[model samples]
Target: MSEKVEDRIKELEERLASTKVNKATQKSINFIKFQLARLREDLIRIASSKKGGGGGFGIKRTGDAQVAFIGFPSVGKSSLLNLLTEGNTHSKVASYDFTTVTAIPGMMNIEEAKVQLIDLPGIILGAAAGKGRGKEVLAAVRSAELVLVILCFRSDGTINLSDLKTIRMELNNAGIRLNTRVPKIVIKERTRGGIHFTYKGHQLMDADEVKSLMNDLKVRNAGVYFSEPDITPDQLIDFIFGNRIYTREFVVINKSDLMKTPISPEKITEAIGHEHWVMISAKNKENINTLRHNIFMELNLIRVFLKPPREEADMDEPIILHRGDTLEKLCRKIHKRFINDYRYSLVWGKSAKHPGQKFDNLDHIIEDGDIISIYLKR
Candidate 1:
């Protein structure tokens, strides 16, 4: 398997080098591809950290991702989990504050990534300094790779900048330096907009209208782009999406289905400022899948196909793979490890269309929509 994995890496490197006849032209594309390769190393790190019982205030799940969720009280963190997993949990959520006190970690599948969403206590200003749940707040944010800034938008459908500031300050106090770099937003709707979307107050054509917006907004620091008009949606995203986004979108949005007369998807788009946005009903199950799909898409993550041995009748079924992945990462996850753990494996589909391609290591960088089959050692 090592030999085969090395061969694939060599092939990819060669292709990357050969295709780049001009060093300066394909810089961005090459940079992104390089980051994609680097993610394999990250998978190894995530796998290692999980085995250690999740580093520090962070808790690891039985899978491959180390994602975290943070917001103010009654910001509907648990409710968001219920919507994501449809799994039974506590609380329905409301306009009030201070809902969840303890951390309720939930398993969420975003495309090829198996992510752990940590519903920590609602963070207030000075959380790190031990003021207003500060100690607990800092503890939670200290170990997160991804952060979600959930806000209960003001009565007029505008987000309170101060609330945003509080979450940032609290994280800083907690010792996590998350800024426009590692944050996403979820604005719970208090008003109108259909399941469909609209931009800048105009109605989007379909229920998935938010997808384009998610791609466009990307991520940026309010401090950095405070006075740059050239920082339009696409440029803003390109500038901050990966260099600061960990080869993915550092920003995301949730809570669209809550509106009574919901604003147009376009209005949601303009309101987003400079981060990826998606409307979801953290309480109701409506448009949740849409939100999830947007998450997978905006992050630029590819899904790897998981298949059982050839003897199995259903050999085509696939499980997705993303960053923070490892072979031992989910030992309990494989229906049968001995059966799946062959010394060598084959990869195909989007990444390497030729079937029967071989690989040596399970930790190899997997592209989106990759099909894989493992061969056990004798």
Candidate 2:
């Protein structure tokens, strides 16, 4: 199976490289890309089966959030981990390549939220193909709520584009869609009657092509809905595969202090074409505070103080939640019985219309720094 996959990959690579880019070959190109994606998916599944599901490193998730630091060898991941999580479980730091071999977990207390930080082993080229500890590293990354791509300038004072590209490719192959959202497509499987699709916005691909792809995936009876425009074949394939991960990413250009000539933020932005980035010297502890603040904001966390009955709100340690979390979800998080026993909740915060506004809707979205008191039947 591996040999067949390699042969097909080679064939597709050759065809893709030699094919002309014109309207006549657009559909053919799209189909080739889809086939390549499917083949890669097969390769990953085969590899995982061989390794067994529980072979890789596993860490019980703790804290308000989990963020992973991923980069090449000697990219200051360990240094950053130690700096961000001072006096906690410190990752080993040495002036050597691959100093860290496994995932090192640490806790960073930003404001009142305790964030779990993992320093993963460095990823090398061909990591997606099991080079270095790529499989383990990617598995760790998959479990992270956020990914911080740490990059460093080479001795020649040049940003390594090839390294960045390789890391990005490995992540892509692992089904980790960085800085991307889940496509607004819903699939409802039916018992029979074949495949049916209802598209509201403008379609990017031919309807017949979509139907053909759906049939290839063996979606014999299903209803597909596309709510957004410019949906591509790859997105459709991702939906069908159902294992793809979509998460936010923030880039960190480390070792900025070591550069002989200072590199401007504008140049870095131009090179990466990504707006969300921070420059920090983890070793020197420069801009580490700013980076912590940035991380807290990027996580989209909100603090809600729980007020019980006649007692005042516990402002010291508020319940942390993500943005857009509703009151019903909060109730479920607190306890399953709260849902049935829920009467009405009084709120005071930015989300409320006035001070101590009463709301019976469990679906009311929560806001940061909101104080709420839950009332139940006596």
Among the numbered candidates, top lDDT falls to 2
Per-residue lDDT of 1-378 in model 1, one digit per residue for the tens? 323433454555456666643424334434434443443233223322432444323455554454566766765677887666557444345567676665677777764466666777777754443445545444544555556667654445544445766676455423345534433322232233322322332221222323333322331112221122222332323333333323222333344433446566666556545546555555456567876775555444445556656743233444544444444332224656643654766766554547757766666555656566666776
Q: Give candidate 1's root-mean-square deviation (CA, Å).
A: 18.7
Residue 285's lDDT in candidate 2:
81
lDDT of model number 2: 0.82
lDDT of 2 by residue, 54-101 (tens): 214666678888898899999899999988998677789898899999
What TM value does model 1 have? Answer: 0.53
lDDT of 2 at 364: 95
- The 10 consecutive residues of candidate 2 with the worst lDDT sum are 47-56
